[model samples]
Target: MKKSLVILITILLSAVIYGCSSSSEAENADNNTEDKPTLTLGQTNWTSTIVPTQIVKQILEDMGYNVEVQDAELGAVYTGLSTADVDIFMDSWSPQQDQYMEEYSDSIERISASYEDAGAGMVVPEYMEDINDVGDLKGREDIVNNEILAISEADPAMEDLQDIIDAYDLDMEMVNSSEGAMLAAAEAKIEEQEPVVLYGWEPHSMFQQLDLKILTNEKVPEIYGDTSIHVTVQNGLQEKAPEAYNFLSNWSISIDDMTEMITKIDDGQNSEDVAQTWIENNQDEIDNMKSN
Candidate 1:
């Protein structure tokens, strides 16, 4: 009887051990299946980028994504995306950003177009009817004396502007300052009805508030070298967060739409308010993108 009882106890212990092992494996599998993916978005320090980034964030949140926004430099953003530190970037300007793209194409994925025809050029107040084009600036140098040409800090466009200046031999001096400072200067001048010429671009709040006109030039191409800002994703982001990637791939906004949102934000509306208002106004567009 003792021998039979020992054999029975050993068999029961073996069964219990096997059951626990199977349960542990199943639990691990369940945990792996239930894990949620986190996505990172990279943003540049420009109003054009900021408004759109916020808009993109709202759309992704609506689709149930864990999203993080990282303020990054132009070059660093590309590097981050290549290394998977950033999962998405919505502000990749091409031709201008072509160098980075070529270098990192192996690691990162170019997803879709964000905005096209983001034109850049020198702009003057509407009152300056005399200066219709870049070439006209040379004849009116006396009138534009102390006329500060404001520009963003370390902008790549400055190089092109410099080339134009050198090629045309214009007398106007280009003033380098932060975007805020430049806008402040331009706004102050505009308020006083003083003549001011500054570097400006589309899809910016300044377009809505300031009565400025972009100076046409034969030298500078109309479309800035066929450059369109693009959406980019990390190598495996599509597989990890397919929903978010799909939404991003379909994301696009017109220059007019962005300008209005930027105008609201510049007028002291909060970023979220600006974004929410724009999203509400453009519900159909947003729905179509999301549905697709």
Candidate 2:
């Protein structure tokens, strides 16, 4: 009887020790997760980057990560990342941005390709189907009021548009304004069912908010081709925030999908609401991306 009691006591002691170890390990893991630094993302003033960056911020926050976005000039934001002031950005337009990245190759690392293809052009609502390419704008002075609604005068898109205008000998004059002005003008024209042309690109929410079509530029096909967009992180992001880095590494998004998310925001839905809505709908897919 004493032998049996001794064996039972041994079994109970082993069980208690194992349970304590498991609980202690779990608590340590939880504390490690909570110790991760708050992530800061940087985006340029370009509107397309705003919505998508917000989506990432919201997702990270939803997963219990603290995140914030800093919107600044293109150069400033890139330089910020190079200095490790920013954690990550997923809105880079490559080929255009490649040379800039080259400058910071040592400090910043291209962790993953977020988008495989990108394009830009003069865009009009789908109703303007009667007009096909950039050259078509040459003769349609009355419809467009001899104006090409453009982003800020400092934007590279303005220079590119000027090149197209000169190449096509377009009669339309470039009206440089803020992205907000361009979108507002496009919105008014869209509401009136009138023809309007604005400098636009793929992966922007504007495409989602309006039934728009990109005008082909046969003469300048070299200017806008399929550019790879990537998620860039400061050096050692993986070591600093392994889980967050891992989640961002595999978060691939198509232009169309980004467009949908952006459109929801452009339509005045709160960015957090839109991101949360997307996360709720795609929980399974997001989980798959984060899975080991």
Ten-residue stretch with the least lDDT total in model 2: 152-161
Best by lDDT: 2
lDDT of 1 by residue, 127-169 (tens): 8888877888876765657354666545566777677676668
Cα lDDT of all candidates, in order? 0.78, 0.80
Q: TM-score for each prediction? A: 0.80, 0.77
| Error at 262, model 2, angstroms | 2.1
Tens digit of per-residue lDDT, candidate 2, span 1-292 = 9999999999999999999999999999888668867889998766567766877887787677778788787777788898888888877777667766899888988878878868788888999877878877777767888888988776655666788888988788888888888889889988999889888887787776777888888887766667677888888789988888888888877777777777777767887787777778878878877774
